[model samples]
Target: MNAILNSARAELLRLRKWPAVWVTLVAWLLLASLFGYVFNYVAYKTGGSNFASEELGNAQIFAALLPENLPAVLVQGMPMFGGALMMVLGAIAAGNGYAYGSWKTVYTQGPSRSAVTAGSLLALTLFVLGVLLATLALFATYTGLIAATEANTIVWPAFSEVAKSFGAGFLVLEMWMLAGYFLGTVARGPALSVGLGLVWTLVLEMLLRGVGGLLGPVETFTQVLPGTAAGSLVGAIASGDPSAMDTPGVLNVLSGPTAAVSVGIYLVVLALGTMLLIRRRDVA
Candidate 1:
């Protein structure tokens, strides 16, 4: 237990000091703001809702920043929310030692394989959760600043809705990190792991999903695919909000709670299976 805790602490420290981590977080914030700016800009110029007739570019910023719209915006942005970063870091966290032939050193030092792996997993969880929360805060803060700068204010969504959005985002983010963590551990190549993850997400799964949707019986099963559940959760959050998509109902195809539960179960199984594989493998 102590060994695992120590390992986790070390992982947290590395994550905190890592330049890539901070850089990605900052980039994500700016990306969200950029999206907000574009949305506000086009809307203001075209007589968008809640925009003054003569409102200029600055006031247009309030369109995406309005508290009522912020949650959905964050949720829908999950795909580009540094999922690849999580996977790459996930590879580094779980597989880097194996790449450099360093796992044998750690294994022989003291802790059992279980302790080391478990500790690292725990640490990765904390680090990623912090990133997700920070992402959420950055979005909310930037949005509020826009609203304030525009001399406009909007009531925040009900606490229940806000909580739901955050909770959903957290769950989905964890699942993606687990995908990265598992793939990194199994593939053990930083580039290969990341590339595989991107292709799996952007190509294979998408193709399957689109095909499933077009097929009668398979459409029902699409909700259980790799990226479908998370997409469903985001869809649930963005439901009824036109700003979330060019077509609002595109994400509303699956049941949010069902998808969430499925993804949770899938992650638990995947993590346990990876640990078992690690235990059986010879490290050197």
Candidate 2:
């Protein structure tokens, strides 16, 4: 246990100084701000529409940007760009060790493979938690400003609502991150792992989903895919008229409970798979 803690501390310190980590986090924040507020605010002021606010009146668009809708805004992007970015972070973090021969050196330094891998996973989890909290704070600030500027009554979401959104977002992001870690472990390098992960997350899954609509077996398989589960989980929270919910990657293919369970399963499987692979395989 102490070994794992020490490894985690060391991994966190390393990740903190890595440029890729900062770039990914900042990219997500920028995306969240743009999609969550900037575009909507612009449309509201100009009496125009964007993907998310299409077919809605200016008043409805404006309302969606207020503090009350922060929960939905927070997680709406996770299944798409948010998840993809996190997967990249995980892939690079794990794969870079091999690219730079850091993993081999660490293995030679006396710690068990399990301890080192477990510590790395723990550090990644902490980073995911930090991103979620940072996003929450960023969104809160944006919504507060919007509310004050519009002279609207501030109605914060209920604690339960915020908690549910936070949980769902964490599950979705963590699942993707673990999936990336697994890929990085399997590939044993950052380049291939990052490339494959981004392709699967951003392209392959969507294509498969599209094809699934016409094929029963494919559709059944798609139901269990990480993207499907993540989308459904967000859909459950951001439920409304489907046509108006133009957020990409948000789906309603499964019930809320079912989607949550599927994501949880993926999270466990990916984490365990990554660790087992690291433990059994040669670092070199």
Candidate 3:
């Protein structure tokens, strides 16, 4: 345990020193602040307009919004603001050992091969979480100011609700990150893992969804995919009120419990697969 902790710590320090890390961090902060400001501004400008009310509601609805929802917005929008990018970066971090054929060097360290890999993965995931935390903090400050200026009062979502949503998001992030890292390990190239993730999420997933829609009943088959599971988790967190859904659709099937379970399954399956792959595969 101590070895793992030390390895993870050392890996984290190395990551912190990388130029890419600082670049991504700065970009994330800028984008997050911009998004929060724009969202709040638009909501404020349209405060009197019925258009805003129709979608999110007026001051009355705003007052009723919970504090917990703040985290949901930040996390759910993460994919847009460097969540996927960070995962790709993490994949590269993990595959770095193999990039220069440095596995011998890594394995030469006191830590075991599994320990070194796990430590790198842990450091990257925690860094992503830290980014989330920073964005959430900025969001809270912006949200509080909006509420004050708008003078809206209502039962904001509890901090617990936000935490619950973060937990769900964390699981989803871990599963995706692991998938990328493992792909990098097997493919022996960071680009393959990163490209595959982007293609799978942005292209293949959408194609599958379209095909499922055309096939009707067979859509359930597509639901088993990692992307489907991730969508369910996001849906659960982003749903302000199911009663307010614009239309009844399959999204209704993804209740909180269902989303939580689906994400859990993905994580467990990926974890098991990683263990099996590492145990049998050559380091090179």
Best lDDT among the predictions, by candidate number: 2
lDDT of each residue in 1-284, candidate 3, tens digit only: 77777878988898888887788678867865654345446654766423223555554345323343475555554433344565576567656667877665767656787776677767877886887677777777767776677665534567787787678657666667777676777676787887877787667766877888889766877777766666666667666642112211114346668767876887677656765666567765
Q: Total clashes, candidate 1?
A: 0
Candidate 1: worst 10 consecutive residues by lDDT?
A: 49-58
TM-score of 1: 0.85
Who wins the TM-score comparison? Answer: 2
Clashing pairs in 3: 63-154, 65-156, 66-156, 66-157, 67-156, 67-157
TM-score of each: 0.85, 0.97, 0.81
Single out the weakest 10-residue window by summed lDDT for candidate 3.
242-251
- Alpha carbon lDDT of each predicted model: 0.69, 0.90, 0.63
Better of 1 and 3 by TM-score: 1
Per-prediction CA RMSD (Å) = 4.4, 1.3, 4.0
RMSD of 2: 1.3
lDDT of 2 by residue, 30-136 (tens): 99889888999999888889887788888788878988888888899999989999999889888889989999999888588889999999999999999999999
